[model samples]
Target: MRAVIFGASGLLGRSVVCAFNDMAVTGTCFSRTAGGLVTVDATSADDIERLLSRDQPDVVVNCVGERRPEVWAETPAQARGRNVEAARLIAEGACRYGVRLLHISSDYVFDGKAAPYRPDSLPNPLNAYGRWKLLAEHAVRAACPDAAILRLPVLYGSAQFAAETNLTKIARQVSAGVPMEMDDVCVRYPTHADEAAEVCRRLAGALLRGQRQGAVAHWGAEQGLTKYQMAQLIARRFSLSAGHIRAGEADAASGDRPVDCRLDCHDLPAALGPLRRWLFHTEFPPVVEPWLLPARPVSS
Candidate 1:
């Protein structure tokens, strides 16, 4: 089985690459071309078409997107280019080449007013990022009717930088003994990138076998936690004091966020057997610890 993974240098993409290690995989990146990742401008239709023709892979997984909500709110055009245009180009290429596509989407597509959302649920995105993602989904589906769409929540995994992901950023602050306020209001299901990668691999396999065509599925951690609870877990794991971390309302500066977008994930479990979720207490420490700064000296 041959596969092409776009945005292969990203958090989820890296894990997806590892998950498909047994297969012939070609990983592409836009700018961060490390670990032998091929550089390809995903927004360019010609670039996408050329790659699809050259690789001739049975499956294509798109992991590229502007995940920053503030980017969409601040610079809508740039964000739309990355999030929507890129996806459209990829989907067009996949349709032309008759290749199976699995596109990564976000849970933000739905307003937090609804607790657990299914695949068929009406998407009422509140923020620009969500709105763009929803648009991207429509574009992808229109271009490639058989494309598989997988919606995921906040992801945490091995990152080169602490700021690459929200959870690792919190871990960084906690490790530094930096006094900070975390959101106790919004509920989030932070899924590990590795777990999402596994789901991607399984779905890709199914797609190759002529299954799950035009299917929309959700994969998220069943455990619901807030930024405050996540910080506390990080503190406990590293034996660091969480005294400086206080639970409060969501940071307004971070931009508009959902209250709770817990995904039902019924389709994924039904299609792929049981959903595999990693335990936060056991799996999170190693993923975040490597990026943490050196411990500061205690003041006398």
Candidate 2:
């Protein structure tokens, strides 16, 4: 099956592309630094159409998101254009070309008031990124009802593009002996990009096998851990010195980050069946240590 991936160089996009390598797949990547990839403008429906006609992919997965949270406030327009507008264009193109779309979303849609939000829950996004993503999801559904909207969180992997991922950024900083300060209050479930890709692949397979009215799936780790706990886990996994690592105040004022954005995947697992075990059991490659804590200085 032919699959076209937007933001292919991203963490989740890479995994999705790699996951489909074994299948009868023809992959096309849309990016500014075009090489063998198609330089389709994500916000332009015409460009999307031209590229869709060129590839004629059975599935089009929109993995595009403006990830710079710090700059989101200053450039809300850019963020909206990239995240929401691009998704709208993709949905329009998908409906026009009769291609099913898998638009990736985030867990930040919830206000953190509840743990494990259901697919039917009404979204109450606090931050600009979350709001834009929510808008994109709405647009996609309106344009093409047969679109899989996967709401996930905190994706991490070894193979990353130019900008480092959350885990990778922390790992690199810790590895360099730089002081690491993590929020001990805020909690999230970190989903490995590889495992996420497999889930997405299974969804696509299910679609190909018939059931194509579009479904929403939430995927993530079983345990909801804080940033500090996640940092400690990584330190332990890589055997990094945790002495330099410290806990910091939660950025509660910046955006409404739910204390427990934990996703309940009971229904999702039931749908995926045996693949659910593979999802959790899939060990993250030993790029760094699992979880570690600094030793306390003792005085005699």
Candidate 3:
């Protein structure tokens, strides 16, 4: 099926484009240039309509976000416009064009008080970012009854190494002997972007086959790991000193995140294993090695 992915320059968006190579994929990017891609003025509905008309895609997957939580806290207006309003316009356009929309949402839609939440579970977002995401979900539902909502956890992959991901950024900072403060109180499953993209591809196929329930599918590692726990795991894998990773809580003083928004995948075979394996490769990739400090000097 022909597909259009908004925010195609970002990590998840890029993966989605790569995953759908067999199909006619139109990846929209505003900040960076990629081969055979066009930029979209996301704030304008007319531009999006023009794009939809030109591409004639069967599915539209939106991965755009005003990503930084701290930025969302500081600029709620920008977050609402990008996260909520943009999705609304896209969903409306998808409805008008009689195409399906697969919007990427986050597990942060739930407040931290709960653990291992299913899609139907009530959402009580504690931070501005989560609130905006929840608002976008509602907007999509209101605009397009048959659109699919896929809520994912912290996504990381080798696709965008050094391009600022949860795994890459933390690895770089900690390996450099720069202390990294992570949230011990807030917990989530870290899923690979490649896996998320695969799910999107499969779901889009299902959509094309007339499987559109507007259902929300949750995909994440089954294990609930705190941010500090993830940091420590990455450090150990890199053989970096654990001292580089500090345990802290997520709050207004510390980036304003949820307390326990880990997701439940609802028995999908692809959902993270009963084995509870770490989402990343056990060995540090070569690109990450440069960020690591030289082995500590040994004293006799």
Candidate 4:
């Protein structure tokens, strides 16, 4: 089967591309084109239509979005275009072409007050980024009712840059022995991109088999951790000194982040076999090792 993956150059998108390696896959990126990724304007209807028609893909997976909440606050219009408009156009195109769509969403749709949110839980986004994602979800559902929406938590994996993902950013800081004041207030399920990608692959397979259409699912690591805890874990795995890392309150400048957005992924495993599990200590070291800064020499 043929598949089209939008934002294929991104952290999650890259893994999604690899997950569907068995299929005829066409990957598109707005910028940062590499690995033969086609650059296309996802917001443009003509661009979406042309690519859809040309590829005639059996499934369209949209991993496109403006992930940073700060960026959304800084440039609402641009973020909206990428996060909302792009999704709507892609879903509409998928519907028009009678193709299955798998849209990636975020756990940010729910407020942190609630623990372990379900797919059917009412979304009360606290920040601009979450708000836009929720809007995008609506757009996708409206245009393509059969679209499968998979909501994921904060993701980390092999990224082009350490700063591209939150966990990698912390890993970089830990590697450098840089003093960090990490937030201990908020709880996050730090899921790896590969894990999410595998879930997407299974969901796509299910959709191809004409099952779970119009299903909204949540997939995330069961382990809940704070940024401070993540830093400690990274340091432990790398044998780096976490002495410089100290637990602190959440940064106000980081925007209105949820206290706990841990998702209830029981439904996902129930619907699609067992969910992929990874031990943070075992799985993360190799992924972040390549991007780590060299240790500085100690003064005599």
Question: How would you encode candidate 2's per-residue C-alpha lDDT over 1-300 as one tens digit per residue?
Answer: 788888776678778888888564444455545445556668887778888888888887888788777668788788789899999999999899998788899888888877768877778887778888889899999999989899888877754332356665565556556666778887767778888888888877777666635787788887666767766766676666767778875565445666777776666667766554323123543433332124345578
Task: Kindly give the stretch of ten consecutive residues in candidate 4 with the minimal lDDT sum.
Answer: 249-258
Q: Write the per-residue lDDT of candidate 4 for residues 190-299, one digit (tens) a residue.
A: 88899899999999999999998999999998888888888888888778899998898865335578888888888877888887697666777777888889989999
- lDDT tens digits, residue span 56-159, model 3: 99889999887776667687787789899999999999999998889999988887666778889999887777888999999999999899899988877664
> How much lDDT does each candidate structure score?
0.89, 0.74, 0.78, 0.90
TM-score of 2: 0.87
Model 2 lowest lDDT segment of ten: 287-296
Off by over 4 Å in 3: 159-163, 250-256, 267-278, 281-300
Model 1 pairs whose backbones collide: none
Give the local distance difference test score of model 1. Answer: 0.89
* All candidates: CA RMSD (Å): 1.6, 4.1, 3.4, 1.5
Model 2 segments more than 4 A misplaced: 22-35, 161-163, 253-255, 276-285, 288-300
Off by over 4 Å in 1: 251-255
Angstrom error of the Cα, residue 282, model 4: value is 1.2
For residue 128, model 4's alpha carbon misses the true position, in angstroms, by: 0.4
Candidate 2: residue 33 lDDT (0-100): 53
Number of clashing residue pairs, candidate 2: 14
